[model samples]
Target: MTGHQKTAFVTGASTGFGAAIARRFAADGARVVAAARRIDKLAALAEEFGPTVLPLQLDVRDRAAVAAAVDGLPAEFADVDVLVNNAGLAKGLSPAQQADLDDWDQMVDTNCKGLVYCARALLPGMVARGRGHVINLGSIAANYPYPGGNVYGATKAFVRQFSLNLRADLHGTGVRVTCVEPGLAGGTEFSVVRFQGDQDKADAVYSGVQPLTADDVAESVHWAAAQPAHVNINIIELTPVAQSFAPLRVHRDTD
Candidate 1:
């Protein structure tokens, strides 16, 4: 979606993978509509990229706001060729029994509902135009669940299935859907948000581990989007060499 003048709308563009993806497309000459809740960070992005980047303050969790944002885009950016649903988070790391209900609600709202809202809003336009790509940010947790990954992982699993179902629905519509799942990514506000602003706890998640960087994830997204129109990438799951599968947990009762 780059190397020329294509419009790419990216959510959660305030920082991390979203920001990196926005920059990646903009640097390649694509018009980028960088949307996020933090206007200041978006402003910084627009300032850096100048006219190529249109910074729009957006909270994807708000369905009405998403509809309005999409319908209200300026003439130049209204025709979004690519929609990157990158606005999502993990609220808490506690196990299910001890988890906060509010955290679970938030995870579902942002990671699941918000994503569906964005896709629903943009898909029609893509179909009308006969060409578009929806790049969703999923997680390895969707397939490989960890103890504390309850709601977060479930929401991503929803994302995975939803992407596949979308393909089934859009078979010959000329639109494509791809889910990019990453494991143990670092250098993002993801952990900080999950830990509820506890910097120390967030830092510990990547300590002594060369986790996947935001750029790595962005590059994967870029590659998927840049593929020829004939090729539709179903899913791209990746992780750092330092990260891989773990042995199944075994529990034994002690008498």
Candidate 2:
């Protein structure tokens, strides 16, 4: 493993944090495999990064597709030294009593089961090689649950626990696991996707404040990946200065 150029596999790399992470790793001289469900978007990323980036159309929710993609990777990028589990989303904003069960299922399937599938598919090779790193994208909701966060928050909590448990299980195996949690990230598909493409509503989410950008989270991911093999950064929680914690910001009809 020493002196060999490393390869990184990042899920959800069509845009947002995943795209930034893929670019950063490519710039750092690591061969990057960027996978997402959007083939055209992934093609654009590959075009932008050239041969160093391999863009594959992959849906994390499909276990068979995930395995096929991983197994079909070229030999040069087959032995992934880093795996970033970043394919997830928040579907509906509703309280537990009113929440859409379908949305809840999607969140759980992607955030938890999808992450598990990726890890399970990749970890054995990492362990066999005796060197690798795993970075799972968590959120502030994991610790500070809000009324509408319901299942989304719960899934992140699972991510937090899963990362720690993976670290424990992989102890002494030269494999490291980390969870990167961000508070209020903007300039990504987060709010847009959450609001289901309601531009006005999405814009309102970051209207008056400067939220953390995809680059910020990407930088953190790079920092974790760049650490020495022996050094395992457990969890990193990053938030913009303007945001502290989740709260109901009610604006009365002053006018």
Candidate 3:
């Protein structure tokens, strides 16, 4: 509220949507706290954006560590005006029957639990200050389920509901919440992570047509966050023009 340039805390910021969002915030004159599990990738923040970028090595799945990081934010970056919950991933495109339990657990922990942990740690401050925005990165899978979208889609569904619920609970608190859902995003580690390092499989997801880039999603985050203090953008669902939904699957017996 004082002389502090709007401070934004961004998770999963080492690459992809996280990094792109961090860059956008910094470009718009906001002091950005970029947190991720990869410290080496985070170093690129200082190289690219100089001192305004506070790189913090974080794994949101670790509740204790997440709490410690938020509680220990430096005096300069303590007053967070915006929180971008972007640390999420989808593992393996196999059907539920063939899915790995470990993959399901990891996705649940990171996509759902990790998000809650960060929000629980930071929302109190936002409510106390009576001015803050929480922007969550959801996915279209939340609405339109596919064969292999199982746990990943469920996690995003949680995000969608959580954002709406937060808005409801913070009715008179001057706080805003938004969920940005993207589909078929390209040029990021998402597919790579999802495919478990299979570059060929990852590339195949976007081989035929161009898909939304991390910057595009970042732009959406920026636009929502840049709204007037009195305005709140609820949910922004985006996908490339080349993408769309298909009819429900119905298998008929050939007997």
Candidate 4:
């Protein structure tokens, strides 16, 4: 509003969808506040984008830090026009019965709680300004459950519902909420982190079929944000062409 340049606050911007979204906004002449746990990667973004990108080292899991960061934004970057909640992850593929408690906790903290923390901090400003967009990163697992996807899928389900509810709450406020759910994506640290840095296993997950790239996801975000004031894109669900629904499994008695 000050200089007519939109400002976007992006979380988990050190890599993957976050970084790509930051890059897209910066290239489009928007000021971007890129926040993540990895300062080094964020620094690279700032260096590449120059003054258009402000790198902030932040862990969304820390509510205090998230609040402080939003409250302390500099004059030029304070009026955030877009908030991208893309900092989420899958911890492990273990069945619920054998899943690690730590993994479940981490997933819950980062995927669900961390997301809400950022939203709660920023939505007030957006509502007051009467103009803003909140784009959340969700997953297809939320709709289609599979083996070893117990907690991770559940967390994404929360995202789906949360986005819809925000729409209801922010009705007539001139604010927009969108949830982008991606399936079988590649070219990111998502699988690696989920597999606990097992490169071989991560590679295997995407070995055969071509999957969605970070750029693809970024483009979806950009499109949703670029819509006219009266337009609201509620949800965008995308998957590789090679992927589709499968038949339900049935177990026959062998005795």
Which numbered prediction scores highest in lDDT against the true structure?
A: 4
lDDT of 3: 0.94
Candidate 4, lDDT over the whole model: 0.95
Task: Give the range of the ten consecutive residues with the poorest summed lDDT in model 3.
Answer: 1-10
Put down candidate 3 lDDT per residue, 78-136, tens digits, no spaces: 88999999999999989999999999999999999999999999999999999999999
lDDT of 2 by residue, 1-255 (tens): 247798999999989999999988888888999998997888777887788899888889999998988899999889999999999999878788998888899999999999999999999999999999999999989999776998999999999999999999998999999999998999888888887788889899898999999999999999998888789999999999999854667879978
What's the residue-level lDDT of 184 in candidate 4? 91
Off by over 4 Å in 4: 1-3
Question: Of the pair 1 and 2, which is ahead by TM-score?
Answer: 1
Flag regions of model 1 displaced more than 4 Å.
1-4
Q: What's each prediction's TM-score? A: 0.98, 0.94, 0.98, 0.98
TM-score of 1: 0.98
Output the TM-score of candidate 2: 0.94
List lDDT for all candidates, in order.
0.94, 0.92, 0.94, 0.95
Off by over 4 Å in 2: 246-255
RMSD of each: 1.1, 3.4, 1.5, 1.4
Tell me the deviation in Å of residue 196 in model 4: 0.8
